[model samples]
Target: MELHILIKGERDISGQIYTQIYEAIESGRLVQDQQIPPSRLLAKQLGVARKSVADAYNRLTYDKKIVGYVGRGTFVSGAAAAPTLPHIEAGKAVMGSLKKWGEHADMTPLETAYRCAVDFAGGEPSAHHFYQDEWRSCVLHGLRQCTAKRGKYGETAGVKQLREALIRHAAFSRGVIATPEQMVITNGAQQALDLIGRIVIEPGTCVAMEEPGYPGARLLFTSLGARVVGVRVDSEGIDVDAIPEQAKLIYVTPAHQFPLGMPMSEARRQALLEKANRIGAIIIEDDYDSEFRYSGQVTNSLQSMDKFGVVVFVGTMSKVMFPEMRIGYLIAPPAIAKAAVMVKRLTDWHSNTMVQYALAKFIADGNLLRHVRRVQTIYAQRREKIQAVFGTALAQWFELLPTNAGFHMVALAKRDINIGELIARARADNIGLYSLRDFYYEAAPPAGLFLGYGSVDANAIEPALIEVRNILRAMLWQQKT
Candidate 1:
C-alpha cells in the first residue's frame, strides 16, 4: 500500500484532506471494503482541522466510492475496485518530489495572545467580535441551509444571492459599485490573491508591492514566480511616485496599510490610480481591516474611485468577522472579473455556496452591518486602552507610530536594544512580538516587530507590556556583559 497524498504548494486544507483519501483509494492502497480511518483519527494523522476531514469523507460518500450504515463504520464501496499500481520502483522515483514539500508545510506558529503575554501583535481584533450572539445565530442559520444542499457542487460564480448582497454591501460600505455578475466569491482573500496571481502573473513578471506591506500578499506574489518590487510607503500610505511605471501590477493596502496604519490620502490615491491608468498596471486594493475603523467614516475603497476599471478590490471576513469563516471577495473591473471567473471556474469551482448563501441572508437582513457597528464601538474602547499602555513605560523604549486605523500598531525600537535578541527573550516571557524582518525578502529585511492589539483584552495590556519591558531589560544586560 504505497500511498502518498500530494497537494503541491497549496495551503488549502479541504483539498489536502480529500486528495489524501482519494489517492489511497486510487493507488490500491485503500482497497474496496477497507474501513477508512475515522475522521478524528485521520485529522490528527494529517495535522489538519477535523472539520476538513469530515467534509472530505462526506464528499467521498456522495461520489458513491464510500458508504456508511447507521451504527456501523464507513467502508469503501464493494462496487469500487482498487486501482492498479505501477512498478514499485517507478513509484519510488516520485517520492522525493512529494517529500520535498514537507519542509515548507505551512504550520503557522501559535500566536502568543493565548498566553496573554504580548501587547502588540499583528491581526488581533477585539474579542467583542468573537462568540457574539448574532454571529452564532448567523452560523446556525447557515448550517440549516447546508444540510439542505449537503452533497452538491456549488455554483461556479457563487450563490447568486450572496453575489447580489455583496454588490449592495460594497456600494453602501466601501463605495464600490458593480453588478453582482462582476464579483467572484473566494475561500478567503488569500485564495483571491492566488487566483489573481494565476490569471495574470507569469514567470519573471514584475509586481510592485508596498515596502513593509502585508506579508501574506508578498508571499503569494513571490510564490507565483513574480519578481516582487517594493515601493516605499509613507504617512499617506504607498508612495505612488516611487512605483515604477513599467510594473505589471501593484498591490496596496490603501484603506489602512498593513502594520504601518496609514491611510492613502486622496491625492496619493488619485495619483496611483492615474499612474495605473497610464502604465496599464493593475492595482490590488486590500481593504482587509477597514470595516473596523475606530473613528470617522470609513473612506471609499479604491475600487469605488476607479474610473478606468484598473483596481482589483479585495475584501475578507477573516478580520472583521472570524478567521474560520474563510470567506472573501474580489471586486474586479468587469473585464478582469470575466477573466478571473474563467480561471476560478476551472479551479475550485466556487467557494462553499451554502456558506455564501447564509452570508447573503446575513447581509441582506442587515445583521452583518449591525454587527459591524456593534463591534466597532467595542474595539474603539479597546484601542484607547492599548494606546494608554503604549504612552507609558513602552514609549520610553520605542517610538509609537501614528495609527489612524487597523488592529495592529507599529513601534520603532531604540537602536540601543538588539531587536532580534529582544524578540527571543520576549517570547520566553510568553509575549508574542513579531519583527518586520519576518515580512521582508532576504535581500532586504525590514526592521521592527508587528504587535497585534485586537486579540489582547483591555485588562491584559499592562501585564503583557511589563513582561515585554523586562525582556528588553534582560537583553540590554546581556549586551553590556
Candidate 2:
C-alpha cells in the first residue's frame, strides 16, 4: 500500500508528516505496533531531506507517539491511544420532534427480565428454549451465501428467499396469505411501524392506538408527528366504535394484546375491518408473541380477514426467538408497499441481509415451527402454574384476565394499592415487576401487572407469587392502620 504525503506550497513538509501521524494515532486510525515507512524511504517518497524526516521522527519518539526498534521500522507506541470524546449538549436549533419524543418517551424496560431472579416483565423469550445448534447451522449457510455476493447492493424490499419463506410461515402459522411482492422485511416490527408511518403520517395526522397498547409503537408515531388518540380496549380487543373517524392510521395487537393478553373476538375483528374500510384509514396489525398459544382456536390474522386492502400485518422473531435476533416482516397493500419500499430505501437502503437469510433458512428448514412447538409446551406449563396460583391465593388482591394465548397474562388489581411502592419493594426483593401504567397515554390505565412466563422457570412461578402475596398482605395491613 502506498502512503502519500502532500507537500503543499513549500511549507514545513516534516511538520506536516508529524502532525498527520499524531492525529491518526489519536483518532484510532493507527494502532499500537503498526509499522511506519523507513526514514529515508519516507523522505524520498515526499521529496524532503532525510534530516527533516529524522528530526520529525525524533520529536515523535520524545512525545511517546512512536517508538523505533534497532533493526525494525518505527511503530506506534503502546501508550498511544485515542482520547475519549466529550459529550455535547443539543443546540437550541434541534428539531422540535426530537423534544416531543423525549417528553413522551419512557425507555421501556424491555430486557430487564434477565437481571432479576423472578421476572414478570413481558415480551422476552427463554434462552433455554432457543434452538442454538439449528440456528447456528442456518447462520453458517447464510455466511457462505453472503460471501459470494459481497460487493453487490441488495433490494430494499429484502432478499427474495426470505420474503418467500415469510410468506409460507405466515400462511400456515397465522393463517395470513401474501405473496413475495407484498412483504418487506425490516430490522424489527418497530422499524416496520416506522416505515409505514413515513408512508402515511404527516403533521397533525390522526392516529388511533389501543390505550395501554405497546408504548414503543406510541412513541414511534408520536415522533413522526401523528396526533395519536388512545382508543378504549375491553374484554374484546380494541373498541371499534371508540376509534375517531378522523384517524388515518389504526394500530392494534389483536392476537393477544400487549401488556393485556386478550385475543380479539371474531365479531370485533370484522367490526374493526369494516370501520377501517369505511374511514379510509390504514390498520397496522402487530401480531407479536401470539404464536406461542396454549389453547383456544388459533386466531386468523386481520390481514387474512380483510376484504379491503387496509391492514398491514406485522410480525417479529424477537418475541419467538431471543430479543436480539431482530428480524420482522410486514405484509402491506400494493400502494402502501410501493411507498413503504421507497421509504425503507431512503431510510436505510435495506436491513442486514445476512441475518435475513439466516432467518429465512430457519423458517424454511422447519426449525422455526419445531422451536415454537417445543417452547409452547414449556410456556403452557408456566402459564398453568400462574393460572392455578392466581385462582387459589392471588384471588384476594387481583382478578386474572382470562387469556389462553401468548407468554403473558394481566391481573387487574381488585383494589387500589400503592403500585409504585409495590414495584420498588419487589425490586428490593430481587424480583422484577412492571406496572401497566406506562402503556396508557391520555388517562390513567387500570391498575394491573403483566405476568410474563417467558423468562421465569416454571418451578419458580409459585414461590415468586407466594413472596408477592406476602408483600401485598403487609401493604394491606399498613394501609388499614
Candidate 3:
C-alpha cells in the first residue's frame, strides 16, 4: 500500500500521522469504514516504533474518530456518516454499522440523553481524587523501585502485595473477610463482572437481576447469553421474594443500588443470602459506591454476612478513586478463584503492573483512606446542594428521594409528564441528566429522573436547576400545543 503520510512540522512522528489521518477524514480523503494500514506496517513505513502507532490509534479511539475492531483491524468509523435523530430513541435502535459487542448496547434514548454545560453523569467520582502531587509521588516511588527490576507477572490471580492490601482494606472498610489468595485484581468491576460471567454463566442460563438496576451488569449478563429476569426492587432494596429460585446467578448492588441510590436493608440482605444458599445459586454482589455513605454506620457488605460462600464480592476503586485507575477485584470462593485466575490470564494477562504497584503503595501509605474521607466530605456537600436546588426548582412537579448516602438521587417527575420529552428539553439546555425509566426492563415501572450530583459543584447547581426547570416548563408547553 502506498503510504499517504502527511508530515506537518515538528510535532513528533506519531502526532504527524494522527493529524494527517484526522485531516484526511475531515476532508473526505478517507471514506467511512476505509481500512487503515496495520500499526506495525504504518510504523515501519514511518520509521518509528509500533508503540507510537498504537498510541495514535488509542487516542483516536478515545475521541470516537476511528474504529478498531479486534482481529478485523482498524478503519474509519462508519458512525461518522450516520444520520442524527432529533430525539433519543425510547428503546435500543441501530445507531451505526459497528457490530454491537459488549455492554454499550441496549442503552435507550433516555439512558443516553442529557447534555450539560456542566455534566453530573452517574458512576463518576470527582477529579480531586486524582491529586497530581499524590499520583506523582506514588509514581516516582514506584519507578524508583522498578529501576532495580521490572516486576514479572507474579501470579495469575494478582500481585500478592496488592491483594494483601485490598484484603485488609475490605475487612476494615467493607466488613468482608477475605484473604489475599481469595482475591483477583481486575480491570475495574466491569471486567470482574465479565470474568465471572465467563466462568459461571453458560449460554442461555437464567440470571436474576434487580429491576431499576445497573445497566452495565444487565448488558454484561445479556451479552453472555444469560436469560436475565428482572426482580423488582422496593424501598429497602431488591425484593428477595421476587427473585426465582431457579436463577443460576443473582446480581445485586446491595451496598447501594445504582441509579436508584437505595441501600439494601439488613433484613433483605440476610433473606437474599439465605435464599441464594438454599438454591445453591451464586450471588454476585457489586459493592459499587459503598465508600461514600453519608448516613448512619455504613451497612455491612452482603459478602460479610454470607457463610455459604455463594456470594462473589465485586469491589472497584472506580467510584471512590478514579476510573482510569482501572483496578477492581473479586473476592471469590476458593473453588471459583482458581478458575477465575485461568479465565483472567487468557483475557488480559493481568492489569497494568505500574498502576497496580502504585495502588499498592497508595493503600499501604494510608493515602487512599485519607483521600476517600476528603472526597466523601465534598460529595456529601454537593449532594445537599443539588437536593436544595431540586427542591426549589422541581418541587411542584417532582418528588426527590432521600439519598442519605452516595453521589446520586432519584426524582419522580409528575405522572402526567413525559419523562423522555422532559429529558430532551434538558439536553437542549446542555445538561446531561439521566431518566430512571431507562433503568427498568418492563415497559414502565416508575417514571423518574436519575440525577448525579458529585460530578458538578455548588457553583453549578442553581444554574443547572434553572435550565432543568426551563426544560420541564417548555416540555409542558409543547404538550399543550
Top TM-score prediction, candidate number: 2
For model 3, the stretches where C-alpha displacement exceeds 4 angstroms are 1-115, 477-481
Off by over 4 Å in 1: 1-120, 126-128, 131-133, 143-151, 296-298, 442-446
CA error at residue 421 for candidate 3, angstroms: 2.4
Model 3 scores what on Cα lDDT? Answer: 0.81
Per-model TM-score versus the true fold: 0.76, 0.87, 0.78
- Candidate 2 TM-score to native: 0.87
**Candidates' lDDT values, in order?**
0.76, 0.86, 0.81
Residue 249 lDDT in model 3? 94
Each model's backbone clash number? 10, 0, 6
TM-score-wise, the better of 1 and 3 is: 3
Mind giving the per-residue lDDT tens digits that candidate 3 earns over 1-481?
Answer: 7559855555576777777777677666777888898899988887778987888888777777788888998888733354333575544455442345523554633344433677767776787555668777888876766666565664667777789999998998898987898999999999999999998898889899988777778888888889899988888999999888789899998877866777889999999999999987899999877878788768889888988989899999888888888999999899888889999999988887667778888889898898889988888888877778767877888888766677888888765777777767667667776778767875375778887776786688788888778877777788889
Sort by lDDT, best first: what order?
A: 2, 3, 1
Give the range where candidate 1 is weakest over 10 consecutive residues by summed lDDT. 101-110
